[model samples]
Target: MFTTVKELTEQSVKSGLPLSEIMIRSEMDTTQKSRDEIYHRMEKNLEVMEKAVDRGIHEQVRSHSGLTGGDARRLQTYLKSGRSLSGDTLLQAVSMAMATNEVNAAMGIICATPTAGSAGVVPGTLFGLRKRMQPTHDQMVRFLFTAGAFGFIVANNASIAGAAGGCQAEVGSATGMAAAATVELAGGSPEQSADAMAIALGNMLGLVCDPVAGLVEVPCVKRNAIGASTAIVAADIALAGIKSKIPCDEVIDAMYQVGRLMPAALRETAMGGLADTRTGRELKQRIFGGRAQNPAVEEK
Candidate 1:
């Protein structure tokens, strides 16, 4: 029923319900499903994400296109070295984010936090938080529902599809959702959670969906890593009493406008941005056997 972050937060505050419970009730009301059914479904999603993160970090699986792999393992090793300048949780989150995306690239099972292309942020942050928060299993599941709450608003008010709103809509929204959920998990208020989302989304407002070789590798995986890292920082900012001047809903609307203004080549068509770089073009040719230019665009 809530269509904006302001409305969602106000409702949560007024009803004395956590954002996650509000989201769960919305899902139940919309689908006419029992609370147990909805919670079990989300639990299954969490299980899948955990497995994918475990598999990605522990194994060396390569994508069929040979575009991306192994970086997640490398990140994990780096994190264990005690030499990384990044904070422990931050590095772990980036690694887990990379791990999840690597699994996606390898075509392994992953729960699309919102979408397959930007699936890494939520689980990545959650698993990383386990090392710090040691949350109960049920608490972890609630984290996901909290994320779902923000994601629901974003998808309805703006977009979550890269083909529609570019990477800002995908990784951007995922990171924003993760940041909001992170605030809640860290025991921040619902208002702080909303501020976290606003900060995260405001920072990632104009990311383009420029997948090289039409594969969700390359920049996509790294972008997820960056998004996770950014989420942690944004959560910190919000929890520290800093607030976004532009509200969350307005930021999302701005992201949608920016995405609409983006050229078609920047959207998922792979004709611009990094997709058109020399190395990117060569890699595409090496992988797909040609430029793989759109036939209609070629004709036009």
Candidate 2:
């Protein structure tokens, strides 16, 4: 029944329920599944995320194109050294987010928060919050439900597909979801959670899905890491009582419009942006050996 951020927020604020609970109740009502069943399913997803993060950091995961890998391990190593410019917690989340995408690039199994391209943000922030807040397993699971709630709104109202929209819809929506869930995990109000989403997504406007060499390596992995940081900061801002002047739904609408207006080259066609740079093209030619598969653009 809660198809919009406004409706979900009103339901949560009026009923004195957390956004997670609102999402759970909606799941129960629509699917006729008991609360425990839904929670169990979500718990399985959490386990998958945990496994991906662990494996990504533990093992040297390399992509087929050999474009991304080992960066997560390097960051984790720096975090352990205590010499990182960013604190351990932020670096941990960033590393974990990079970890997930590293696994994805290596063709490992990953739970897409909304899309596989933006898979890292939600779990990265949740596990990062765990480092600082020490949330219990139940709290972490509920955090996912909260993320799912916002993700649901984004998928329904806007777009979560890189081809349909861009990286803004993929990573942008995931970052917004993580921000809202982070607000709830930090005990912020549902309204504040909405503001967190708005701020996070607003910061991500106009992001394009221009994968170098038409592969989800290069900038894609790093972007996921940055998305996690952006989500965390956006949550902090919302918890600190900052509000986005534009409403969440309207921001989503604007994103959709921007996506619609985006040049086809920017929407995962890999024919524009960083994908077309001299080094980007060189990297593509190096990796795929002139076999980079960007069907949208005819190869010369």
Candidate 3:
């Protein structure tokens, strides 16, 4: 168990192994499972993610509340038109990210890379990379392992639950994980992967988790799209030899501290931030028939 990015990178350097292999070995040791077993397990998860991404892109998946749907298809259609100002890869990532979350919102199956709310970023970047990088199947699986390694560190040292640490913990951690994994998949060094994680996470620090109507549809789906875009950019920056002055572990710690200081209303309580706005309250009332006020605090 590498507890921090520094330890993870140091071990990877000392052993001349990719971060994915280290995580695989660690999982084997911890679970007393064979390497093939663990790899196959993660492969199953990859399949689920692939299916969700495909379904979302091809179908108009709408949530029960009808808060979010069809946007992924809209983006894909826009991509097909080739009139986008943003680059194809970035827009593709954003589309896929929204697709996965849209599927999740519609109660479709999705493999949570860290959490279901932030599941899209990893596979979003992975498929986006497929366009140009053309990584093999095994390499794709390793990409997920690399992501899981960083996610493990965040879940253990900081938090991966939005209820505990806000959107910064959920989507922010997933973005960092995806950024590091993206660097590794692109053949960057372990140090470069660490830099990507730090840079990506720093960009998302202190993000609130104020889902409108106590649902994960409104901002959550779009946040995943932005997170994917950020992860790709961060990975490119790291691959370009740009390093974050704040180390990866320290950035994660800072995320933890910020989450700790964040008000409860911003930490998945759905009583503040966008969730507390006049329009947000109106949406809540419409959704729940005017009984959606925070249970612990009566609305004046």
What would the TM-score be for candidate 3 when compared with the true structure?
A: 0.96
Please estimate how well model 2 matches the true structure, expressed as its whole-model Cα lDDT: 0.92
Looking at model 3, the pairs that clash are none
> Per-residue lDDT tens digits of candidate 2, residues 19-57?
999999999999999999999999999999999999899
Candidate 3 residue lDDT tens string, 1-300: 789999999999999999999999999999999999999999999999999989999997999888898999999999999899888999999999999999999999999989999999999989877888889999999999999999999999999999999999999999999999999999999999999999999999999999998898879999999899999999999999999999999999999999999989999989999999999989888878866345887776
RMSD, one per candidate, in order: 3.0, 2.9, 3.2
Residue 269 of model 3 has an lDDT of 87
TM-score of each: 0.96, 0.96, 0.96
- The lDDT-based order of candidates, best leading, equals 3, 2, 1
Total clashes for model 3? 0
